[model samples]
Target: MNKVSKELKTGVLLVNLGTPDSPSVPDVRKYLREFLWDERVLDIPAVPRWLLVNAIIAPFRSPKSAKVYRELWTENGSPLKIYGLANERDLQTKLGDQYIVKLAMRYQNPSIQSKLDEFQTSGIKDLIVIPLFPHYASASTGSVYQKVMEIVSKWLVIPEIKIVNNFYDYPKFIAGFAANARKHMENFDYEHFLFSYHGIPERQITKGDCHNVCKFGTCCDNITEKNQHCYRAQCFETTRLLVKELGLKEGTYTTSFQSRLGKTPWIKPYSDDVIKEFGKKGIKSVLAFSPAFVSDCLETTIEVGDEYKELFEEYGGEKWDLVESLNDSENWVNLLEELVLENSHQK
Candidate 1:
């Protein structure tokens, strides 16, 4: 390994799914406009996507979504952005003066373009980017990479860029989730455990199944060379690993996908249906975990924690506890440092 040089310091960019700069309707609308317009996210043809986003989704959903974001806003700010900033500070401290760490959002304020500009001025010729999604999805990790490259290509000097695409199966990741879940489980005798991950449209998975390998079936039950990048497969693999480490009993837990939008059929079993089924079965208690997210965003905090719990209770269930995300945890900090150091070696 070459000795670290102050002039050639590595810039570490930590990215997460963005939040509205404020919880106001106009801010949420602005955030949604940028987020939904991303080709990778909407994945539909440009004309219709533009029509749908501009004419329908953005305007109608914005005010209502603003209310939801209000529920997620913390004293400091949006929990997603707040925790992302904390992660940047902690990782910078942990990595010491040799590395410069900055946080960015794929959309909205503190954007990837702005962060890269700072790195450029700082004279960082080497970069390591980490998208905070555990599972690899075109809309999330891929979007971040595409945006970064698009920005840096205009510069005369392109840094040697390395992006940690996904870390769903990293040991430290699984361990961190397991530890968080155990903390919640200590309070109640959970009758069942549920692992719910954010859902993407089925077409997105099919489109990315480049090798003709994704069967939309048990083919994704195990990770292989063929389905390595399949988002659903990677999500299931994360659950498999975390379940093993937590010593969870088979049949006592189930994995489902959540947060379907405009529904052209997303990955199933849908989390709402899962909750209804548990209610029907008269299961009174459950511990839920959102393993795909590394931070407690609107998805984890409101969707899984609040909405799901309300639905479960409505269906005759008693206790529904959501395990918090791996936001700014010591394990996560260590994992980030290790990932950066390992990538530094590759250069």
Candidate 2:
């Protein structure tokens, strides 16, 4: 190895699914309008897309989603923004001044373009991009990659980029999730554990089908060789790992998807429907986990925390608890440091 006088500037970029700028309806409308209308996200044509998003989806969905965001917003702001800032700070501390850590949202404020510019201006030559989606989807991780490439295309000097697609199988990542769930379980008497993740439209899933695999039934059943990159498979993989870590028995726990938009089919079983079923089945106490998201966001905080809580309670369930996301947890920060080092070595 040659020793050089210049320090190799490496950037650690943390990307999340994103949230509205505020809890207001208009802001949520803007956020969703962009998020749902993405060709990569919806995987649909433009004409029906415009009608679906603007005329029907945005008009009704925004106000309802905004109310959910209101429940999630704190005095500071969205929990996603709050925890994203904290995660960046903690990762910076763990990385020990050798790397620059920048956080951005896939949908809204502090966009990928602006963050990459900040990193480029600061002389970062090597980059580690970690999309906070624990399970990778073309719509999520691939979208981030597209945005990064789009921005870097304009820059005079392009940094070498390494993307962390999914940490679903990472030991430390699994441990952080198990530990968080265990902490909440200690206080609450929960009879069932539910893992709920953001739902991507089924059309989006098929576009990345890789082969004829991932028919969304027995197709996603096997998370092995050919279908490993499948987003649905990875979500199941996360559940299996967490279940093993927590010593959970089969049928005692289940997984589902949340936050479906428009009339099209999304990956399922849906979280809202599952909660109702639990109530009908006499499952009294339940604990919900949103492992798809590494950091607490509007989806986990409001969609799972507040909205699901109300649904569970309304249906006569006894106790419902949502596990806190890995927001600046020591294990998470250390895991991130390891991820950066591993990727840098690979380069």
Candidate 3:
């Protein structure tokens, strides 16, 4: 890689997790195959991962997932893709013609391979890769980073690549969430608040340097140099920031994890359990926040808003309202602009 010249155009790639092309079994199956087959995602050997994802999970899960996708679809299309594409287009206009801003899903259509293919010959000497995940996780951000490098490395001459990591602590990022949540919290009469982040396998946590510092108890309460990259710790840090930013008391909000798969235990305080307990404890009227997701997709829109809401209501809770993600919000667009300008010119 050579040093970038001042006049060189910068290519900004904003990568989201992804959604199926349509709410169809075949399309959903295809999406699942590409998503779960990743080594970073499935985290199993080649043959087993292939057999499990391709032969079993994808084939069976697609039908059920397609139904959920159908429920999640809007008049425009998949909300994740819609919001992501809008971010890309608007961000390009905000950045003007000086930079080429494009959006891609890590999994299905608009795949990273095809997107990087454009930048491969776009005459851009500098490139910025921002995985849209707020926190650093092997399955999410790490997978995006690996896939990007794998493709870009093959280019005859690679651009001066700069892949930005987690923005968990970015002020504007937190402010965006806080601003969105405040609109819902204006009433501020709810008995409790829940911060439900996407869960990862607990083994994935101890699998990395986090084993040195993370006990997944009090260790996650504070972010340290050793455990900084720990997904669990970063999740807690996000919760801490939101609590302070929103002026909520310590005991008022609880942090939990959702969307766990398989039988093995995931990061603790599972969201279902927490919601059930909130009802069992007779706590009603709760506000839920999913900071793990920046856009309203299946996880946020259906899972958190609908399914979880039903669970809470069934368990005796009166209300379970979810705070929307920062989907194409002005605050988020501002943050994206800062990310591009601040890193694109680095020494």
The candidate that wins on TM-score is: 1
Clashes in predicted model 1: 0
lDDT of 3 by residue, 134-221 (tens): 9999999999889998898788898788888999889999999998888888876888999999999988998986347767799897
Listed in order, each prediction's TM-score against the native is 0.97, 0.92, 0.97
- In the order shown, what is each candidate's alpha-carbon RMSD? 1.5, 2.1, 2.1
Q: What count of clashes does model 2 give?
A: 0
Winner by lDDT between candidate 2 and candidate 1: 1
Off by over 4 Å in 3: 1-7
Task: Encode model 1's per-residue lDDT on 1-347: one tens digit a residue.
Answer: 54545347899999888989999999999999999999999998999999999999999999999999988888999988888888999999989877899999999989888999999999986999998898899999999989999998999988898999889999999999999998987777899999999999999999988899877779879999999999999988988898899898889999899999994989988999999999999899999999989899999999999999999999999999999899989999999988899998333
Tens digits of per-residue lDDT, candidate 2, 1-347, equal 33441466688999987889998999999998989887778677899889888998888989988887887789999888888898899888877666889999988988887898789878876889998877788888888888888888888877788999888889999999899998987787678999998888888778776677777877666587878888888888888888999989889998899988768899999999999999899998899999888778777777798889999999989788899888878988888888888997423
* Clashing pairs for predicted structure model 3, backbone only: none
lDDT of 2: 0.85
* lDDT of prediction 1: 0.91
